[model samples]
Target: MRTLQVELGERSYPIYIGAGILDSIGELCAKHGISKKSPHLIVTDDKVGPHYLDSVVSRLKSEGYHVLTHVVPSGESSKSLDVYEQVMTTAIQAKLDRSSAVFALGGGVVGDLAGFVAATYMRGITFVQIPTTILAHDSSVGGKVAVNHPLAKNMIGAFHQPVMVLYDVDTLKSLPAREVSSGLAEMVKHGLILDKDFAYWCCENGHKLLALDAETLIHGLERGCAIKADVVSKDEREGGLRAILNLGHTIGHAIEAVGGYGRFLHGEAIAIGMAGSAMLAERLGRDESLYGETIRMLKAVNLPVQLPQDVSIDQIMDAMQHDKKFTEGQMVFIVPEAIGSVSIVKDVPVEAVRSVVEQLKGEG
Candidate 1:
């Protein structure tokens, strides 16, 4: 197994990446000081349960671990206070203790919600992430976990790192085409903001990566995680350098919130958001050629480069106002100066944002 570690001092954790590593969950947990005797909770979603949850449970059980399962409805809606409380109640009812560890055995939603539970239960408990989708390659690693409030996505979250992240590439075999495309968007984002080489590699090999070809998927997953790990290592709480990771996320989150999360997969919204931000960058005269390149790369991967036809400018503005990146009621946007380059724009004028949205809407 290829392993990467998140160096967060006391909260440090390891991310294990390889094909068929789900079978090694028991040993992984054990290595991290988790035991069979300790109460273990497996949190998954309806969609993931039938596919992999049972196998995960059996793996841990074979190691003589006592395991319980809690499956939530799958989708962005699950990231709500109601489901968070439900999982917490289940953990409490099961008598999960400080020694206990929670196993998140699904995609981004499962990882985020379960990790949030682990962070809050009994003050804090250990959690392991078993990501089942490509999009999770980013979400599972960073310590950011939380549910969406009614007003905003990820408004209530904590910086609770996991004890271990077992990224079994095998699990992604069942991912829908949309999910694969969604994940590629993030990998694309990594290249845009940090590594130009990786970005070019993605443009060349996106199809192979999406096909779930074993070697290509593993390479992309490892490379993406490596970039994310480097960024998080320097700024765990997103106080500074880490904000670069939000290359498309600032406007992306607003789009998601306005469109009601499920309308566009996180990556789809990012695809459009990145395009819009690139346009904004062009208008601001940061680098016209890079903006054109951004559009080309996004379209190359089948990601939407235009805003949705149904979305209104007012809805987009309302969502941006509620974005977590807003400071002192000002919206901050990360725009690309060039491929493998980005700049943060704070207090972006409402008129500038409106003009871009109008132009995008008109084009669509």
Candidate 2:
């Protein structure tokens, strides 16, 4: 087992990454003053609930903790005001309080929903993240929790860090290939923003990494989470440095909103968004080699580098305007100068944005 710590002064937490950590969740919580008699809310989805929820409940129950399970439909659509309300209702029925804890037992959706529930319940209770999907490697770490608004993705959320992140690699064995690809997009994003060597490592190890090679997945995820944890420690609220993590999120979130929440997975949309951002960088006279390498790497991993065929420039631009990156009515972009380096460019011209969007329109 490899352990990484998110150093947040008084709010410091440890992320335990390895196999079978899920079974030891009860003892971990106990270390934090939570015992089996404490009320524990296990939030998951229909797809993931069947696979591992029982184990968590059984473990907690064996330790004598009161456990309540709330399983929602499995998908991005569940990240909405309606679904958030339903989970809130379930928590109320479970008698959750300031002393209670919420354990998110699924992927990003469950993590976001459960974290938000914990953040707001009784004005905020502690929450632990037990992520089932590799995609949660990004969402699980940063405490950036939120349900989606109709206008934008993650527009409605908070910066509530998890008390503990118990990532069991064994849970990823059942994930589909597409899910694996989606998760790696963030790994690629992490490499692009922080470590050039890691970005190259991803492309070099692409096949084995996506094939669910245990060592590759564990090492890649630990590195990605460590990068994010370092960033969050410095800028927990995205005051400055943290925004770099939104490398592809601006155009990427727009792509997701245009697709009506279920069209593409989060990482898939970000894959295209990263491609678009890199194209915009190229238009600004950034290195051509970096642009080509990024696209090549994405394609090598079977990720989308273009918008959906039916999606248009106008639709994407309209959605982009709603992104949180905009300041003083100008859209801010986190552009890559090369893998491992990025620039925050604001007041980007619409014509310049259109040029890249136009190039990718029919390419899909």
Candidate 3:
């Protein structure tokens, strides 16, 4: 197994990445200080329940852990306040305490919801991440966990890092094409904002990664996590250096909120959001050539580089206005200065954003 540590002092944890890592999860948990006798909750979704959850539960049971499983309805709906409340109630009824830990065993949605529970349960408890999707590779890290408010995406959340992240790349083989495509959006963003060479590498090797080649998938995931670990380590609360992590999120989150949470997967919306941000970058005098290059690479991965047909400019603009990146009513966008570089620009004119929205909509 390839082990990468997210060194956050007392909050520190190691992310184990490799094929078949899930098979050894019981031992992995024990090694990480999770006890067999501890009351544990494995939070997953319906979609992932049959495929991987049972195996995980079996392993934990064999290790003598008292494990209870809670499978939420699959998709963005699981991140609603109602579900969050229900899960918390379940944890409470199950007698979880400060020592009891939550095991988020699905993708981003499960991780966010369960992690939030771990953050608040009995004034905070331990949480382990057993991410089954590529997207979770990003969400499972950095400790930014949350559920969506009725009005916004990830509008309510907390910075609760996991005790450990067990990324079993083998679980990804059965992932649907759309899910894989969605996950790649964040991978693309990682390359764009932190490492240009990594960005280029993704463009070149994306196909192999998608095909589930072990080496490429592990390497790409490691590189992406390394970038995230470094960023979060520096700015745990997203105060300063962490803003770069928002490379495509301002526009992406806006698209997601306006389009409705389930309309597009987080990564799918982010793919389009990156397109919009790249276009805005050109208009804001970042780099004209990068605008085309960014779009081309996204398209190569079968990611949507354009807005949806039903979406309107006004809705997108409204969502962008409400974006968390906005400061004092001014919009802040992350635009590319070059292939491997990004800068946060508060100077992007609203009119520029409007134009990109219109243009992208036309493409759809």
Candidate 4:
């Protein structure tokens, strides 16, 4: 196993990444000081539970921790106020307290919802992440946690850090091809923002990833986590530089919400969003090959590079305005300057935004 640390002083924690790492989760958490005396809750979804829950529960129980689990239906809808409340009620009924720790044992949805539960439960309890998908490689590392709202994605959430993240690449083998492709979008985003070489690497190797090449995935995930961890360490609250992490998320979230959460997977939406962001930047007079390269690469993986033919511009515009990235009433967009390089843009021209979204819609 390889271990990397997110340096946040008092909130500092280590992330373990490797094949078959799930087997050592109990020993790992105990080493990190998660008390065995407190009740432990494993929050998972219906999809991930069958493959992972038993192994996790058995490990924790063997370590002398009283473990309980709350399984939510597997989908983005589970990250709602109603579900959050239901999980909260479960915690209360289980008699869990501040000392209790939450184990988010699935993908991004599970991590976001369960982390939020731990953050608000008795004013903050400990939580650990056992991410089961490639997408969670990004969401699992950053302390950003939240449930979605009708108006916007991840609107109701918090900056709750996990005590540790245990990523087992083996779980990915069981993921469907669609889920696998969806997850690669975030890794692509990570490369686009942090390293030019990494971005190109993802473009070259993404197809291999969908075929489940274990070595490529392990390498891709480690690099993705390192980039995210470095950024989160510097700006834990997204005060500045960390905004780069939202490279394609601003527009992506809008697309996801407008299409209805279940319509497009998070990464699918991101694939299109990143393509649009590149085109928007190009239209704004920032000439970069990233525009064409992003489009070409995303297409190679069968990821969408444009809005659906049926989506209306008005629907997307309405959703974008309500996006969390907006500041004081102005939109802040991340635009690519070159491969692996981006800058957050403000005062984006209305005409340029409309033109790009309209053009992308026409492409579909």
Count of steric clashes across candidates, in order: 0, 2, 1, 0
Q: For candidate 2, lDDT tens digit of each residue in 1-364? A: 8899999988888999998888887788888787555577899999998889888899888877898989999998888989999989988988887788998999999999889988888888998999989889998988888998865567788878888899999999888999999999999889988899988898889998888888988999999999999999999987889989988888788888888777888899999888888888888889988778888778766799887568878998888776545555556788899878898887877677767777767542
Query: In model 1, how large is the Cα lDDT of residue 241?
Result: 82
RMSD per model, one decimal: 1.8, 1.9, 1.8, 1.9
Off by over 4 Å in 4: 324-330
Error of 2 at 93 (Å): 2.3
Candidate 4 whole-model C-alpha lDDT, 0 to 1: 0.86
TM-score of every model versus the real structure: 0.95, 0.95, 0.95, 0.95
At residue 35, give the lDDT of candidate 1. Answer: 68
**Cα lDDT tens digits for candidate 3, 1-364:** 8999997888888999999989898888888888656688989999999899889989888888898888899988899999999999889889887678899988999999999999988878899998888888889889998998877678788889888999999999889998998898888889999898899898998788778799999998988888889888888888877888887777788788876776888888888888888888787777779878998778767798887688877887888777655555457778888887888787676766778888888741
Model 3 TM: 0.95
Clashing pairs in 1: none
Q: What is candidate 1's lDDT per residue for 1-364, written digit by digit as tens?
A: 8988777778777889999998888887778889667788999999999999889989889888999999999988899999999999999899998899998988899999999999999988988899999889999877999998876678898988888899999999999988899998998898899888888888888778878888888888888988898889889988888888988776787788777677889999999888888888887878768767887888767788778678888888877776655565456788788888887778777677778887777752
TM accuracy, model 4: 0.95
Q: Residue by residue across 1-364, what tens digits does model 4's lDDT show?
A: 8888888899988889889999898789779888877788899999999998998999889988899999999988899999999999999998897788999999999999999999999989999999999999999987889998866668899999999999899998989888888998888888888787887888888778878787888888989999898998888888899989887777788788788777899899888889988998887788766689888767766688888789888888778877644555557788888778889898676556667788878742
Report how far off residue 187 is in candidate 2 (Å). 0.6
Of 3 and 4, the candidate ahead on TM-score is: 3
